[model samples]
Target: MEHKALWTLKFFNFDPSKTQNKRRRQMLELEEMWLHAYDSSRSYKEQLKSKWSGPFIVKSVRPHGAIELVDPAANDQQSSWVVNGQRLKHYLGGEVERLSTVMKLVDP
Candidate 1:
């Protein structure tokens, strides 16, 4: 079974590295991106926890796929950090003003 799995991958010329490089990403500034939250240690009781965080603002898209993210809720960003694009996925949830009480009157 292991040999068949290897053969299938080889036959399909599956290369995850190349696939990652070929992924089309046009992460514009101020767009929302969710950072993947990975937990190595987990308790069985914590099943309701989320695996992703954000709807974070895309502060900048750096060269070589590095992204700098900023929290939308936090006006002060002294603890902002950079992360690889692989650890993030674009947030698909649309902006719904009815659910939240924040308003942007002008561009800051």
Candidate 2:
């Protein structure tokens, strides 16, 4: 029993040092942002729909990997929210334009 318990603990343990090796946030303040949609909101047939939405502006970066974003399409400050860095991606306008062009060619 003791041997089994020791082996399980050793196997399940994570190296604390490894957690520090994660890549730094790619998004920055004042940059355009996109938040990923919830998986439950998507359907299998409409899988081609974009997984991200918004060209929201990055309002501020918070400690512990949270970011504040503002939706340019909305007039009220209530439209803003703080989200974790993992849920966001930097919005690239040129890439979006290129993708739309490609999609038009493929679909029409």
Candidate 3:
């Protein structure tokens, strides 16, 4: 009886293939993002280093979630490289707020 009940539950359960993954891509629009370091072979001295690198500018967004990145500090566009969107996270610069203040040009 116990084995029969387990079999029935599996048939009624939801299918994983039908489920949609909403978090499939990181950022859709072109913006700054950080690339996860894929270097598994690391030195013993550099064990404490952060795995994520770059606040790289998003040069373009390709089909099938492919993203091209370029170094903002670099003068030429030759330093650009392509990476997957999953391996990247947005670089939202400490979430700083922008506020503008107007000043009088001359005294009345």
Candidate 4:
């Protein structure tokens, strides 16, 4: 059987008025969720290791407020994020890992 590579993207939007402390906590939790998702997906892990050279990266696209993730092998696979035309974040692969919905937490 041949294994085909797949990509994912996830989006999460937060209220602009949330407190900084609340936002910080939310981001930390979101990172955990992202890690869980990454670990559960075998293809994602292998691709990240086989393709990326350094640690995984996340880039923020402002205004629209989107974050792009890069692992390794980004350049080879065109996996990094671009703003206007400039490439942002470290190269993880020629192709980027599929993104997923951003995890949001309600203020507590």
Candidate 5:
């Protein structure tokens, strides 16, 4: 068994204060990107959708210096999961961080 990175991600909350209609459009873009990235990048052992849960859970891993996204749900849906370089290492955490396949992030 391996220790997993327990991330405190906030995708469902936070408001951008943009016009509601524009915000909705922006959110849709983020959502699409998140779904696409998860489908392509994460390992099959992980769940990439909003509705799934597991003991070996995977949460949304944000980019470095990415302040709590105004709307993580929207941002995650628009941007790609930054799965390169030290990014993966940061999320994996501790000893399990060495095992790249142990966990992953999905579009929340």
Candidate 6:
């Protein structure tokens, strides 16, 4: 029991004050866009998967730099999930441009 306690103490010896601040200053902005990291384990074929998914909108910012995402299609809270800032990447319309090009090819 003493060994276990000492191990636990050593494992949690991190200083809360020394934790690095979030590099993302835009997280606090309302309706900011983000791409959520995808769970690649769910894919049956390893090569047919993307690293991140969705251009989800930021619904709200939590106290510790966590963010609540908004469902763009549904516009409801039912399908939303909270994720840490590090797990997200800014969605800069590259996907949208690709989608538009695909749509043009199909329609034309």
Model 3 worst lDDT run, 10 consecutive residues:
28-37
| Model 3 C-alpha lDDT per residue in residues 29-91, reported as the tens digit of each score | 222232222233445326524323547778899999999988766688677778889978767
Give the Å error, residue 54, model 1. Answer: 2.1
Worst 10 residues of 5 by lDDT: 50-59
For candidate 2, write residues 1-108 as lDDT tens digits: 999999999878966555544322344321324323333345643652432356877789999999988876776956777878887877766554332333445655
What would you estimate as the lDDT of candidate 3?
0.66
Q: Write the per-residue lDDT of candidate 1 for residues 1-108, one digit (tens) a residue.
A: 999999998979988877665563434321323322223234432642432355776789999999987876776875466878997876779873444578879978
Model 4, global lDDT = 0.59
Comparing 4 and 6 on TM-score, the stronger one: 6
Predict model 6's lDDT versus the native: 0.62
Per-residue lDDT over 1-108 for candidate 5, one digit per residue giving the tens place of the 0 to 100 score: 123322323333534665687889999999999998887777553544432221122334456633221223453544433232342223343443333555677999
List the candidate 2 regions with Cα displacement exceeding 4 Å: 1-52, 95-108
lDDT of candidates 1 onward, in order: 0.66, 0.64, 0.66, 0.59, 0.46, 0.62
Candidate 6 at residue 91, lDDT?
79
Reference-based lDDT, residue 12, model 1: 92
Q: How much is 20 displaced in model 3, in angstroms?
A: 55
Give the per-residue lDDT digits (tens) of candidate 4, residues 1-108.
Answer: 122222222113444556687989999999999998878897777875664456555554555545555545455544665333243345555776677899889999
Each prediction's TM-score versus the true structure: 0.38, 0.37, 0.38, 0.24, 0.23, 0.36
> What's the distance in Å from true for residue 15, model 6?
52
**Residue 94 accuracy (lDDT) in model 1:** 85
- lDDT pick, better of 1 and 5: 1
Residue 65's lDDT within candidate 4 is 48
Q: What is the lDDT of residue 1 in candidate 3?
A: 97
RMSD of each: 20.5, 21.6, 17.7, 30.4, 28.3, 21.5
